[model samples]
Target: MLHYIENSKTQVGKELVLMDIGAEYHGYTADVTRTVPASGKFSPEQRVIYDLVYRAQEAGIAACKANNDFWAPHKAAAEVINKGLTALGIIKNETDKHPYFPHGTSHYLGLDVHDRGTYGPLKAGTVITVEPGIYIPEGSPCDRKWWGIAVRIEDDILITANGPENLSAKAPRKAEEIEKLMIEESAFNQLELPKLD
Candidate 1:
């Protein structure tokens, strides 16, 4: 997976891209991406909806326990995103923005991002990413109030005999959660600065 930020020289526009590529030794592939604001902060409205995406991701991970179907996480994440978005008045119904988040939540992770394996069910020792996202582009069918705002929360996971383990725990998914962590780290750095005699 790759995350990138780009600044425009001619325009007041910035771009962020997250790309995930999966290949399989037996012939399979899984690819996905999620773009977001790079300034470490989202607009007020964006935050409300973005939090929903984060929650969906967490729910997906939690559903990846042993004895679950390989597609369970995706279904769980999608339901969370749909219900959350609907409650926030962003989407009218669960299947509203089907075009944007049409892809599955988790895929096999090995040689390819969507590694080759049996898709029927999930067994212990499977790795994947549970990502839930919502994209609102200009002139979309939905309300224009949220145009141009895209939010996604993705995390790598490993299915275990007991449950699932998150691999990308280092990435921040919450608005206040991220802000607090960043602020604490910044303060720590200042305190560690060399003292001037």
Candidate 2:
């Protein structure tokens, strides 16, 4: 994305991307996504929104545990996202349901990207994903302080006898961490390819 933004002449306005990646191994699947600034460093507006989703994802992951209701994570995540939006003055009130965040947090992960599992109490060893997002396009009802910014944080989690374990923990999720990763020299950076006429 940094390369694209730097190399291309396209002007950025209210454009955002929500990238989803899933890999299947041994019949099980993993799903995750991270939205970063195409310019490598998050702008002020983008940072706030990104942090909100990150904190919400953390809250959702904490709710994934044995014997807890399957929807607990979603509820937990929604509450955090709702309150954050309210506190940031992005929305009118925390009690008011906002369309900006309209998806559940967790789903089973197995044969399919959205694997099948009981909506009842979560059992130990259940693999799931905790993803929370916020999307605010240009010209929305809210203030311009929160426009053209879209963010989603996702991580694969596993229910354990004790608590939740993050399977994709190695992946960088924090704003600073992402910035660092983006700036690091890529393996392909030094390779030169000859242009064909």
Candidate 3:
């Protein structure tokens, strides 16, 4: 994926686009993507809502435990986001038509981004991402206050007998956490850079 991003720069746009494909040894494949701030630092407003989305993602992952239904994570994540947005003044009411979160909470994740599977009393083996997003496009109602901004957090998880296992735990989703990691990593790289011989 890194090689593709680096070499195929001409094929991509300035905005970050989450695009990746995965294959399992057991003949399963998965693909997912979430656009991020190319600069690696989200604006203040973006961070505020992004954190809520991350929290929702966490809630969804936590709901993927054994005996839970496939829809459990979706419901959990959506509820979390809705609650957070309500508190943040993004939504006037629970059923209000606000653009705060315009996407589904979760989806079937396997060979396809929206994989097909029985979404029922969850079995021991299920994988999905609880991605919630907020897109306030220009000239839109929500855009009046927060325009040209979008935030989303996606994580891959596998249901287990004990609980959910995060497959994409390496990715940082927290606002402060991500910023700190980026700064520390960048400093480390700079310190390791050799002076021009």
Task: Give the winner by lDDT.
Answer: 2
- Those runs of model 3 whose alpha carbons end farther than 4 Å from true positions after fitting are 1-26, 32-35, 181-197
lDDT of 3 by residue, 83-175 (tens): 877787666666666665666766777766678877777677787766666655677554355565566667778778888888777765567
lDDT of each: 0.68, 0.85, 0.66
Worst 10 residues of 2 by lDDT: 1-10
Assess every candidate by TM-score: 0.73, 0.88, 0.73
Candidate 1 CA-lDDT value:
0.68
Query: How well is each residue in 5-113 modelled by candidate 2, as lDDT tens digits?
Result: 3445466543445567789899878998878677778888889888989999999999998999999999999999889989988888999977788777888998899
After superposition on all CA atoms, how large is the RMSD of candidate 2? 4.3
Measured by C-alpha RMSD in angstroms, how accurate is candidate 3? Answer: 5.8
TM-score of 1: 0.73
- Compute the lDDT of residue 28 as modeled in candidate 3: 64
Clashes of each: 4, 0, 0
